[model samples]
Target chain A: MNLTVERVSAGYGHVRVLDELSWRIPPGVTGLLGPNGAGKTTLLHLLAGITRPWQGAITARDGSASVLSTGKEYSRRVGFLPQHFTFAEEMRVLDTATYAAWVNGVPKRDCPAAAWAALEQVDLHSKSRDRVKSLSGGQRQRLGLATALAHEPDLLILDEPTVGLDPAQRLRLREAITSIGARRTVVISTHLIEDVTYMCDRVGVLAAGKMAFDDTIDELAKLVDEDAGHGFGSAFEQAYAGIVARLGREA
Target chain B: MTDTAREGHSVEQVLPRAPKSTAPRTGFFWPLGVWYFLAAFVVIAGVTLVRTSLELSFAYEEWAHTNGLFQRSALDITGPLAAAFGAYLSGRLTPPSRPYALPRFARSKAEFLAHHLLPAATVVTAGYVLGLVPIVVKTYSTATTGSLAPLGFVIGIVILNTLLVLGWLFGVVAQSAFAAPIAFAAGFAATLCGYGIGAWNSVTPVVGDVSTAGRVETLAFALFRGAFFAIVLVAALATAAGVLRTRGFQRRLPPVRVFAWWILPAVLLAVGMVRPPSPAVREVNPPKICKEAVGMSFCVHQAHERDLDDLVAEVEPIVVLVGQENLPFTRVEDTALHDGANPHLDPTVYYADVSPRYGATGDRDIIANLIAGSETCFVRPGWEQSAPGYNAFMLTLRLSGDRESGADKRFGKLSDKQVHQWLNSHRNQIRGCAITDDLLP
Candidate 1:
């Protein structure tokens, strides 16, 4: 299912994070790029149903239900991997996945198979019997992804899922996300522009809690001046810098 | 290189998929901490049993009833230890971000709380229940009258669960590095306070001296106390849920539903405080177990039937001596069968205050105390120096087989026949506490 954020405002205590932020996410890999303290995680939290919007609403594109009104139903269809997460270390990998599926409303009888499918998709099925504590950092990230995927949710929201991974682990994770994006909507919030260029079909740059740039990768590249640089990295960097600079000017 | 090999095989050529097992895949994996708690419970329970056994060795009367053993084993020390472990487990399980994490899941608030809290609660509760096993076995071996006191055990369990719930709430609220220690202290204090209250006997698993005849614990009073603790358990859970729901959010009073949960407990508490139940022990007239020996009949409470043989062996010789001497009393009875409100002053029957702590020698002391006459009389300050009732004292020492190193030398020695003759003449006066220096030989 696609999601639409309409004129939403949210924050922690006295600090306003998102201000009248509006964005549409279609069913494909959509990358959210933002600088530090730019409200990327807060926006993801709102989408994941972990936090409530102070004003406006988040709803399915067909207007069937709003996240605020249909919380359990919405949560059942959406899986969220927080930026920082921990698991019960003593639990087996498959058991952790199965528990996640059961918690997301999967039938108890189907949980094991669903967990296996999710594990196979992430290429972590070989390590399913190992204790969670025995996993390395990248394997744990994949296990988190497997937990999110075990319930076969329609929308998977991952916040900085590849933040601390090595380049090889990042590429493997990006490949997994690319294959999973074929059949589901995946929203990835990250600081890496390469993640968007390599895997995302569409990208949104969040600046000062507002969507400063939202378009296809080609369009974003076009916004970069030809005199600036050569490769995709330079062009994307130039484009992101331009958006932040423009947001600064507006502020 | 063949033509069929060059093309892909048909879809039906693959092996058939295995049938899905359909069995529930959620294998419960208890955290290492739960195992640790279980081990700790075993060690603590063993230590408690050994300590209690040693204490009871000197006071066998205390171990003669199942209810007493249940109280000493289940609540006296294990209850507080269970609460502390419960708090530590909950604190370790729930981090500060749990409240933020739980709301994102599809489970209801109650389901989530149960999933998080039940494991720790179960381990603690199961530990409490298992701790009662050795005590029950020990009591079963010797106790003769009262069976297990169900009402008292139920009250103990309710009180224990209430402590656990309170500890769980403390851990949930104080999700910090020091939460475990603070929760442990708070849990221990809470259970101790429950024990400290005046209604402790009502809540405790002690059915006071059910082995004694004419005594029983009132079920209604015990039920009321159990109900109070059950209400506290519910209220604590509701409070914990409320705290979890509002944590990390803007601070405000709990929602109406949370307050609604407390209404019943509050009403019950007020009613209970206003007019509480009466004393738990009540009077009952159970049939006495009797045995005849040496021409004198001996009777005791049914709970003391196991002690009758030993009692008879120790007192039969004394009874034969008294019979030979033609003493006024012809029968010995257990004091437990006596009605304290209305004294039965039959001169033919002597009442003996017996306990399981009394061995053969201790039983002999009972007869000596009776023959020595009443010591509560208002006598002169120098009565002992004057050797008042010296004949009676010598007769008692002879009956009890006690050494006479401190006997008065001023009074002349008397044989058993002379003492018996003096006792026959002054039996009524001795019973009435009328002994004087003039009564001595």
Candidate 2:
């Protein structure tokens, strides 16, 4: 599924967060980068169908129907992983995935198989019978991803999916998400430029609630002054810092 | 990714799906915590049944003649116990971050709230109904006059459900660790106040003192109480849903038109309050059970027929002794056998006190009271010490093998002819409470 946000304005209790922001997200691994309080979480929440935009509209690229009109039909096709989430600690790993699938409108009978398939994707299939409380932090994160994938949603929105992880665990998650991104649209919001350098094909930068840049990672690397730095990491950081500076001046 | 891992993923995706017809059914109370709730139901109901059976055996005097056993067994502590369980379960189930943790899915908010609240209500209500089975069996075994009180059960169930909903709402709103204990205290206090306050007692589910003869609970009054609590239950549900809506778990408030339906129960409650059903027990004439022994007839209320044989056996020897001594009364009847409108006793018929203390000692006490004459006229000063009828009463007790002070020896010293002459002279005084010390042998 392709999502198009048009001139959207939203806020929390009179404090405006997103101001006339518009962006188009296509299928593949797309990375979203922004500084603190740039409405990245708010934008993800809007795309996940959890909160409605105060003004403007979000619709499918085909323009068949708006998300508000489609309601549950649109929600059924999307999966969301919040920045901080927890599960019923006593629930078994497989039961957690199966419950999520059923909640997302999968038929009850298909839930277990779907859950197993999703867990296999995240490499957590061996721990299906273990209680959630017994899982390591990294395993729990993978379990969250399995829950998101269990219903086979067309659009997957992940907010800070790789926040607290060791280097080894991060590499494993990156591989899992990269594999899933091959056939679906995966929007990953994070502050780590290294993740974008490796896993994302396209990158979008948000500054002051507006899209400051949206292009290929190569194009982003090209924006860096080669005379100042040559390596990929320094170049990407320099280019990202320069964009935030220009957008701050504009604001 | 390695070819092996890719191949494994592909295999998992096409793994054999379980048959749809045999799929595990999922709903409000499905594959997750339902077994725990089922276990709770069985334990609670089983314990309540055993407790009620023990109470019936030990305290038969309070519930023998009426449907008091069945009615009180279902209501008394079961309602508050269920309310406390509901409060604790709901409080534990609904944590502070539940709204944020729960996924925004295709199911409606009302359905979601039902998913949380209905399991507790259902389990507790089922346990309560199961607990009433013992009451029914005991009533069937013993009682022969009054039928089981359906209205009492209906009112009890309504009150119980109302308390459960109230407890659930408290747990959801308070979201505190103390919610369960607070709800338990509140439920028990509410019941105490309902019974203690005179005005509320008439409308509360606990109908006190239904053990009167020919008296049974009235239907209209019970319906009034049931409707009142049922309306409270509806209001509590609406309030709980509203709370969830504000928390963003629910997308919409209940429809405005639903409030219009409250008018019916409200009107019924109002009519009941204005012209309350009177005389909570209405009089009904039921059949009597009677037996004959020692040339004397014994009759009892039909409700006590199960105990008639044992009673006749205990009192038959006493009746023989009374006949040998030429006692004035030749017929004995239970005091509960009279018509409700006329309560006068026959002068020649001995009216036995039937409802108290139901074993061997209690039966012997009846004959002792008869020989001692009516105690109502013995309230005069010095009657206890100087009354000659008391000596004769002690003599009868001694003859019956009950040990008393020297009355049996004093009476034994008299010749049979002399004893007969003294008793013949004082027979009227002994029965009429007119004897003096000078009349003693």
Candidate 3:
């Protein structure tokens, strides 16, 4: 799966958040790193196809087939887990997953099974009958994952998916992402450098509503040398800090 | 290095049932309790007013009477209340969290609209239905007597829905929760202005005249008014949907096209205003359905065809009393003498005011009073000269054998026959506008 965004400009009312932003994401787990208002979520929203860009276009292709050309079909191939995944508090985990499947055009008769399978993939099948409000923070985050993955979309976009998770849950999410990324594209937006080092093969850094870097971990690490005495952190973290600092200086 | 990353490969391989991709469903919560509360308030208020007022019997007379009650309740209370509250609620319908944003994988806008409006309309309708219970009770209550007209109730529901949709559309257009008070004010002001223009008056669901067989005409008018409301409702819904799609879903606001949809309703409204039906259309008598009793013809409006026999029965004894007086003529008409335009009215005709404040078609006391020359109009509003009028009126009662009061004792020892003779001699004055006993010599 390949997703392309070109000169995309989107905003809320008069405040423009994503201005002439452009980037290309290929089939793999790509960690989207940015500061708070860096438009990472906006870009993800654009990719999810829920919100439209004021200017420019986004096109997605699965091999030779145009996924973005037909909306419902494209929607079937793109999964989006929003920054704050909101569902009815009283809804059962299974029902929430089923609803996600149904909205994505899973046939009514097949929704239950599809939801079950998606929950099982997220290790949430055991708690499928629990109300969303009753679930722990980590459990809810997993449920969010299950909801997004229920329809088995080809391009999964998760916005700060593990924001409130404990270390164990974060590890669990990293594993889930890696497993899903093997056969499809996964874009995880976050501020955590560890996520990218642990789960992603490639990293895309966004700064000031624009993409500053899009390259493999090895290529990014090449930006900083070990003898430079940059930091005591890992090589990937040193390189990431260097790239972001360089981008800040340039801006 | 991470244990989770190593488990990822296995988690994926073990559970291949997961979809490669999926989007979130629209999880917006419908405000059911608010609607229920609104409905309850309207119903309670309507019931209280009707119960406290003494005008219940007239509502049972026919569709017109019931319509009169609905018109009063809706215009005086429910319409403005519903519009204001509905506007406030709709203004808060969309927030950043629940954008009311169009779903990525929905079948069509119709389906989307259904998902949005079905629950909303249901809640609103439920509230409206709750408000109508008092009306139903009034229709069947002792003071009122009639079978509830489903068509009348349906029209009431449509009117309410139109008001609610208009308020909601206003809120959606405003696009801010803070605009709720403004929306409420605007809705109230707009409807009030519409009322002032008199263009909206005919849209009131009052059945003005039901004595005639004008059901076809009333129904036709009802349908016309309904169509007018339907057009407005559809226009508002389309406009809101257009906004939601362009701004939230499509992210490209098509201002011109979205606004253009309103022209349909505007044109229809203009047509309605320009060619609105007259109040006379509702007030016009139905075809005459007459019955004879006590050697006199008792004719009523055609809508009262079903009640002619009962009316005749009520008037029979009165007619007999009037006959015994040997008056020149003895015809009693069922007309209410509204603005004095009854075609059947003549010098000999005795007009019964069967309005809510006065007579009822089936009330024996009122029918007897009408027959015994009940004097409803007096020159002044005081009890000072009330005795003379009461004495004059009591003479008729004595002659008719309906009742004998103290004033009858003041007849100066005259028998019922003599009192009848005296009233017969002064029949012209008695039937005249200023009813008096000046010719008592």
Model 3 DockQ (Cα-based): 0.17
lDDT of 3: 0.61
Q: What residue runs in model 2 are displaced by over 4 Å at the alpha carbon?
A: A62-66, A202-216, A219-250, B1-29, B55-71, B75-103, B109-135, B145-213, B225-246, B249-279, B291-298, B310-401, B405-441
In terms of DockQ, which candidate is strongest?
1
Poorest lDDT segment (10 consecutive residues) of candidate 1 chain A:
A61-70
Alpha carbon lDDT of residue B8, candidate 1? Answer: 23
* Model 1 C-alpha RMSD to native: 7.3
Residues A1-251, candidate 3, lDDT per residue (tens digit)? 88888889987787788889888889989989987787787788788888878898888875686656236566667777877745556556777777666555555445566677778777888787677789888888888787787666778888888788899989887887788788788999987888988888888988877788988877776787677655678776677777777888998
- Local distance difference test, candidate 1: 0.66
Per-residue C-alpha lDDT of model 1 across residues A1-251, encoded as one tens digit per residue:
68889899988888888999999999889999989999998898788776778998887542463444235567777788877777767667877777676666665555676677778788888787788899999999999898888767778899888989999999889999998898888999988888889989999999998999888988998888777676555678878888889888998
If ranked by TM-score, best first, what sequence of candidates would result? 1, 2, 3
Ranked candidates (DockQ, high to low): 1, 2, 3
lDDT of 2 by residue, B1-441 (tens): 112222223323454453354333555565355776787588557755764765457323323332443334455566666666667655654443432224356545576567666786677677877886666666655556566667666666677778888787788777643687888778777667555643554455455443444455566656667667888788777776665544442144445633554565556556654666652553555467888877778887776565666677777765554444645466766666774334446767766555533532365565655664645335656655655546655545543546535644665466545655665667677677765656656
Write the number of the candidate with greater lDDT, choosing between 2 and 3: 2
DockQ (model 2, Cα):
0.22
Judged by DockQ cut-offs, the docking class of candidate 1 is acceptable
Arrange candidates by lDDT, descending.
2, 1, 3
| Displacement of the residue B278 alpha carbon in candidate 2, Å | 5.5
Best by lDDT: 2
Over 4 Å off, model 3: A6-22, A50-57, A68-73, A166-172, A218-239, B1-106, B114-220, B249-252, B279-289, B301-329, B336-345, B353-377, B381-415, B421-441
